[model samples]
Target: MTSNDLGDFLRARRARLRPGDVGLASYGARRVAGLRREEVAVLAGMNSDYYARLEQGRERSPSPQILDSISSALRMDDEAREHLFRLAGTVPEGVRPRPRETVGSALRQLLDGYPNAPAFVLNPATDFLASNALADALFSPFESVDNLARMTFLDPAARSFFTRWERAAEAVVAALRHAAGLDAHYRNLHDLVGSLAGESEEFAALWSSHTVYGKTRDGKELLHPDVGPLSLTFQTFDVRGASGQQLVVYQAEPDSPSAQALALLGSLHATRHQGSATER
Candidate 1:
């Protein structure tokens, strides 16, 4: 375990939050940014000194109840709350198994069936283990699409590809944070974080905020090179019997412009694949 990692995470998170964010009034000039240490204590229903101790690394273990209270005070989502527990070296019982990196043959076949939609499988660390042709075309601009988080933060094309790039970046970082908390010993995740932190100041700032989240059904807007702008809905599903693997599928509403764009992207992918096969 990295010494003081918990303290560092707590301090960073605290620094990013504001008094007004937690329903507290800002009455006077404040020297520091975010909620003061005492304010967090008050909101969390804990002693100020004790909360300080936790942030200062003097307090190592906090009860689940206390952690829950603190998580609430911090306005943490479910994933972020779980990350807090993990940082304290006490994950709540019955946590699901961490997803593995491998994508099974059955899953690959399922993805192949989605000719129009873009679909792929990601491990807990956001590694793209397998993707269908349409999915490949969707992310074709990236020099490498090995890791979604890395691509979002480090790839130049990401800014254009994701119409709302800043929001997309935050979501990616939060998802990575949740994954890191789930498996701190994941070497690949550690390396990926280290690399992104070193290379991108934006990524570093977001990572320090210690936010946590997971992908679910959501709308995404992207600028595709071949098909122009696309507005699509994406849904992520847990690959049953495959720990730490999630299958993400992207689709557009019927008869929408996005649907037409998707069709064009599919045609382009098919043409390219056919050309390559003929050459071989």
Candidate 2:
């Protein structure tokens, strides 16, 4: 985490808000977009100079009350507010050892249970630790299913594979930011973010926005090379006894077209696997 992450987050969130967003009247043509520094300070009931010092990184330590005021002024959501506290270093820190990336045997068995669905395991940094056969087939279009962030922003196939490409991009970046906040000292996470920011402009821009979110349950629209269009809903579960590991399972509604498509994809995947094994 950079020393200026807090400031950058504050600036980004401030830029997203308009004068009228906080019940303030717009008077004349403003030089910058959204609320100005002074305006934010005013909303927070603090002097602009203090807020300026905080934004400029001159003020390193801020009290919880002050952070709360800033969070309220910026109209941050729960995740964003927690992230703000983390960046400001006002939240109590605990000893969080780096989590193992390996998925357990039981989890592997669980993933296998979803024969027609795509189920995979992901680390905090969004690395594809392990995936079931169906999940592998779902992501077969990518050259390598290494990292979701890389595949989403850097891969050519992602644009076509993800029907809502923009939303997917935003979501992955936001989830990464959330992970960074929780696991601040994880070196691999830092390296992943740095590499992505250097490679993809869109990722860099979204990262700068400081949008922090964790995936729990979400619906996705996907266009598979083999199966064509599919609408799937996924649920993410934190794996017990595995720190920073999440199990994601994607399913299509029963008796729906998407379900039929998923079944067909599974059949094709099984046939290919069987043929490969027979050849071996």
Per-residue lDDT tens digits for candidate 1, residues 1-280, read 2477787777777877887788899778888888888999999999999999999899999999989999889887777777889989796534756557788799999999998899999987789999999999999889998999889988899999999999999998888888788888777788888888999999998887776788798999999888899999999998889987889999999999999998998898889989999999
Each prediction's TM-score against the native? 0.92, 0.97
Give candidate 1 misplaced runs (Cα > 4 Å). Answer: 21-28, 92-98
Poorest stretch of ten by lDDT in candidate 1: 91-100
Candidate 2: 10-residue stretch with minimal lDDT: 90-99
Whole-model lDDT, model 2: 0.91
lDDT for position 171 in model 2: 97
- Per-candidate Cα lDDT values, in order, are 0.87, 0.91
With a 3 Å backbone cut-off (N, CA, C), the pairs that clash in candidate 1 are 99-243, 99-244
Clashing pairs in 2: none
TM-score of 2: 0.97
